[model samples]
Target chain A: DVKVTQSSRYLVKRTGEKVFLECVQDMDHENMFWYRQDPGLGLRLIYFSYDVKMKEKGDIPEGYSVSREKKERFSLILESASTNQTSMYLCAARRMMNTEAFFGQGTRLTVV
Target chain B: GIQVEQSPPDLILQEGANSTLRCNFSDSVNNLQWFHQNPWGQLINLFYIPSGTKQNGRLSATTVATERYSLLYISSSQTTDSGVYFCAGRNQAGTALIFGKGTTLSVSS
Candidate 1:
């Protein structure tokens, strides 16, 4: 079975503070993604990493960045947390050419 | 970029009833899948049907790539099945799955 794990299930941060959310997968997938889910707006991509040291911005990457230092781990960083950034963040990992992806439980970040 | 749209944004059903959820995309896709997000926010993959149909237990999914749409059917619905159903697709390489807003299903005893 594929397993994706997030470092934290919930987090609270003050405005302008830096926040980091970590995600790890045990399946050795090459692709990892970060997305934020909000009411009515659904899930919007924040960033994604295809390989170690390689990352790409998604639809909503303006306030976020990502890093992939190893094949199994990906991290999402909010340079400066803002109140509007409070939302449920999800981390997903998948094989390079596979259609199926595994997701972590999610990190509900509350920016105060 | 591809756009995905799910039908019947919200659905309420009684136990033992059946229902079908629809997903429509704006562009051709290399792959498509259906996922059930449980009440606890865990996403369970239902099917990876780019085309044709596939079934698992009480659930079945049909995807018509040519028409850019997919359908997921739940039989003899149970309260445990109450959750949100999402359809996602890959339209471009090196891009993540573009997901539909989803269909929220609520099952009552």
Candidate 2:
């Protein structure tokens, strides 16, 4: 079974603190993505990486950064946790093409 | 870049009922697919029909690639089927997917 695992199922952070969300895929997929889900805005991509150390900004990249130092793992970083940054974070991975992408269970982050 | 639009943003149904959800996307976005986000916030890929149709148990999906549209049908709906359904169109580059706003479905006993 293909699996995408997130480090935490829930997180609470203080405002101005740094946060890190981790994702790992066992499928050996080359493409990995980070997305945030909000009540009315739906799911919006924040960042994605196609290969190790290669990253690209998505529609909602502000206030967020990502790292892909290894093929199976991708990490999302919150430079400074803010109230507006409180949202459910999801990580996904897929092959280059012709395959279905899979997502992690998600991390529900609360910024106080 | 691609833009996806979904209709009937919200829906309510009784158990054992049937319903359909629609999604439309802009040009050059293939790999049309559907996903279900359960109340627990886990997303599962429901279908990957770039074109034609596919069925899995009580759930089925169809995508018209040329028209850039897709439809998901639910048959014999149950409480477990209550969730947000999303449709996405993958960019030609295969780098990422552009998703529709999603339709929230509520099923009652």
Candidate 3:
């Protein structure tokens, strides 16, 4: 079975603090993505990494960046946490040419 | 660019009722799938129907690639079926799946 695991299930960070959201996948998938879910905005992509050390911005990439140091790991960084940035973060992994994708449980980030 | 749209932003169904959710993709996103987001925020995969029909228990899905649309049918809904339903698919680039706004469902017992 494919598994995508996020480092924290829930996180609370002070405003202006730098936050790190980690995602790791057991499957050796080449595509990893970070998305944020809000009440009515649905899920908006933050970043996508097609391969190690390669990344691309998505629909809502402001105030956020991503790093792909290894094939199994993708990290999302909040340069400065803000209340408006508080949302549910999800990580997903998919094969390069396949359409089936799997996601992690998600990390709920709250900035105060 | 690709766009995924869903109908009935919110739905309320009584137990044993039936419902159908629709998903439409603007581009040629032949690869389509449906997911159920549980209360705990975990996305549970429901069906991956590129084209054609598939059934599982009381749930079933049909995707028409040429028409760029898909439908999910729920039969005899239960309280446990209360949750958000999402449909996603990949564009021609095979990039990550573009998701729809999702249909929020509330099933009452």
Residue range A6-73, candidate 1, lDDT tens digits: 99988999999999899999988888999889889988889988888999899999888888889999
Per-residue accuracy of model 3 over B42-109 as CA lDDT, tens digit each: 88889989899999999999998999999999999999999999999988875677899999999998
Tell me the tens digit of each residue's lDDT in model 2 across A8-103.
Answer: 999999999999999999988898999999988888999989899999999899999898989999999999999999999999998876567788
DockQ of 2: 0.71
Colliding pairs, model 1: none
Which of candidates 1 and 2 reaches a greater lDDT?
2
Docking level for model 3 = medium
Candidates 1 and 3, the one with greater DockQ: 3
Chain A of candidate 2 compared with the true chain A, TM-score: 0.97
Error of 1 at B54 (Å): 1.1
Considering only chain B, report the TM-score of each candidate against the true chain B. 0.95, 0.94, 0.97
What candidate 3 gets wrong by more than 4 Å, as runs, is none
For residues B3-93, write the lDDT of model 1, one tens digit per residue: 9999989999999999999999888886688888877677788898889999999999999888989999999999999989999888855
Give the clashing residue pairs of candidate 2, or none.
none
Q: What is each predicted model's overall lDDT from 0 to 1?
A: 0.89, 0.90, 0.92
- Model 1, stretches more than 4 Å misplaced? none
Worst 10 contiguous positions by lDDT, candidate 1 chain B: B90-99
